[model samples]
Target: MKRRDAYLKLTRHNGRAGTHGTYNPKHNDRSFNLANSEHIDPERAKGNIYWDCFYGFRSALAPQDPDDLAATFSEVERQFYESRYSNFVESQNERNAKIRHTERNRSIPDLLSSRKTCPEETIYQLGTLDEHASGEVLLAVVTEFIEEFKARFGDHVHVLDWALHLDESTPHIHERHVFDCENKHGEVAPQQEKALEALGFELPDPGKPLSRRNNRKITFDTACRKMLFEIAKRHGLELEEEAEYGNREYLEKQDFILAKQKEQLAAQQNKLDELTLKVNDMETLIDEVSAAAYDKAVEVVTDVVRTETRKEDMRMIEDTKKWVLSPERKAPQSTREYTAKHLDSVLGQVPQDHADHRCPLAGEAPEAGSPAERQGADQGKSTGFCSATAEPLAGRADPTKAICAAYRRKIRKLFSIIVRGDVY
Candidate 1:
């Protein structure tokens, strides 16, 4: 196996780009870019790791989305104000004509940038692209390192989030935390030196006063780096601790260049994603509008067809009724012949009113001098008899009324068939 170098870089956040979007990505939107399909391989995203232990320190008023370092710092500042600085603020307001703003009236992020506070960030890797450790082994070692760090510094340092990015060329971890300790007012405030001191970290050179190269922070980082190497050893990982001269700066410069490139690419991808979302939304809206319009058109057509069909049917029924009842008009010869044959049966089946106790043909005055009229006159009978039955017609109503009713029924049946598309 190739021997890998154990790497850890501690940082305090500046105004530069951050790692939150790259850590937890909502890929469907533009919330994240570098961690999306454009820069990070989508197929490999499943192997990425995210572990967040910031819930214990998250404020109730914090944003619901993924935590950023700014929000984390704000929470720390809020804790200091609520627990330690509130009383002092109240007393100052009561005593002075010029009231002091709440919680020192300062921004935590500004103080952090100025080095008045510390926001701890560390990126750990066990290998380089050319000679990297196996992902399984690296993960195991990093897991142990995280547990050890938390156990050692839980009292003063709080872990916000940690992400292991496997989609990149090599596996590595980005962990963030904030160091805090009680101040003179007995209120816990974010202060890196006091917290490291509380954790028993001493200056690198005991004989010298605290300075940039001999600070407790340097001592703390050295101890953490040593712990990481020890954990890797237990996991059977061979890592080099000593760095060659000038190698550290070169690697850092390379890392910085790569980061800026990714940021530019991310910016481009974000614009593309926004445009895609707008196009998709417009497509969905058009489809809905088209469907609604189509349904309304169908409804209007159906209503118009139904109204016109009812009117036409009524006109046809009225015309047929007039022809059958008219003494001067007659049906076609074929229709008359068929009707003549079925007339008796049709007459018997039609509904009758018992109150009309008269001849079936009595209601219709036949053409003068017709056979039925002559027969009635010759027989000296006031009522007409059916020509089909040749018997005295009583209690049966008008034949014309029955014939029109039967014709109306047939016409309605035919209209129903036409409406159902069974007939043209």
Candidate 2:
């Protein structure tokens, strides 16, 4: 049995980053500038090509372009913010577009950066570089695997792009895709744990809370590995389900050698050099601590002021609430209710002869037998607001009703202002 291994990793780098450029030599600046580098053989690099993302068969292979993937990312992100976070955009201006904070706050790149898991890369290879399966067989398996992958995760995971590289030590496919789920605002945003959860993936340790060791992504990756292994088995290549340690184990021969050399050199460093490094690190730490302490002190003082201000405001609100809801004080009423319920009580508060209490034309008390005069006589009081003296209008006006309406309007306005905390 020719036992191979399955390789998959969820990297922090998003599609637009330099990693995509490295995967496709056409987009790599280093490939153009440093063609002599051992990592990529110029002649063999010609065989590497991007996946044909079209409906019909292509005459030739499509060349990999990072800009195409980046454009897709940009469009998706633009729609997400424009559709769901319109409030955040509306609150912004030319001066504070980047500074404004709200409930749905995020920067332009946050759609990519804020995600816990980013684009994942899956490599389909038989074995180590020195011993591996034929390129034709690997290609066929990977092509079928990509189809299965799309069917499995197409909903939550979007395949941005993939490339088949023939320039590397072994033939493999470098496929990249982002995970996303609908956020609270109904926007499909790039998120890892939530996306996986939406896809029905559970934590590795169901009993424990989600953490670095007990994440749902860990379970997700395991399922992907199993799928890859099963697909490889179907294609007549037996794959090893054994786990690999060290992230750098999959690097190219030249890069691996350089990494080992760096490790050896670090191990062989002189004590004097190590001491000097520690002393510099200590100085840097001290500077950081001093700056952090000053910032924390300022934050504490500002919080104290804010807390006291809030306490005073709350106290004022409570006082207003008590006065407004008191049983002894009459709640605000309409003009008709005020006249019927508190007409006598309110009239007694003001003396009949007070200039302000009297209407503009106090001399025009209605004729004794007039309806207005009879109403006042029945009340048996001269409260000045009696329609007899209070009518600002000519003969036919009822001034008591007019005064009650004005008072009702003023009372409503005052209550509204108090509830809004605008009294201060």
Q: For this target, which candidate reaches the highest lDDT against the unseen true structure? A: 1
lDDT of 2 by residue, 1-424 (tens): 3444443321111233444332332332122543566777767766665552332111124433445432232343344445543454344332264655354555544544433433544555566676677666766777786688779888887665555667778766566666777777565666778988998999978999989878987888778767767777787665544544354445654567788888888877776698989999999999899779756654554444333332322222223333333344444434323332332333343334432423332333233242233433433332233333334333433434444445434433443443343211
lDDT of 2 at 280: 100
Task: After the best TM-score superposition of candidate 2, give how far the Cα of residue 275 lies from its true spot, in angstroms.
Answer: 13
What residue runs in model 2 are displaced by over 4 Å at the alpha carbon? 1-36, 52-118, 244-424
> Candidate 2: how many backbone clashes?
0
Spell out the clash pairs found in candidate 2.
none
Instruction: List lDDT for all candidates, in order.
Output: 0.53, 0.51
Which regions in candidate 1 have their CA more than 4 angstroms from the true location?
Answer: 3-31, 35-39, 54-104, 107-118, 247-424
For residue 28, what is the lDDT in candidate 2? 27
Query: Which digits, one per residue and each the tens of the lDDT, describe model 1 over residues 316-418?
Result: 3223333334445344655544433343333343335421322433444433443323333432321121222222233434343343345445644553432
Q: What is the lDDT of candidate 2?
A: 0.51
- State TM-scores per candidate: 0.43, 0.44
What is residue 345's positional error in candidate 2, in angstroms?
Answer: 99
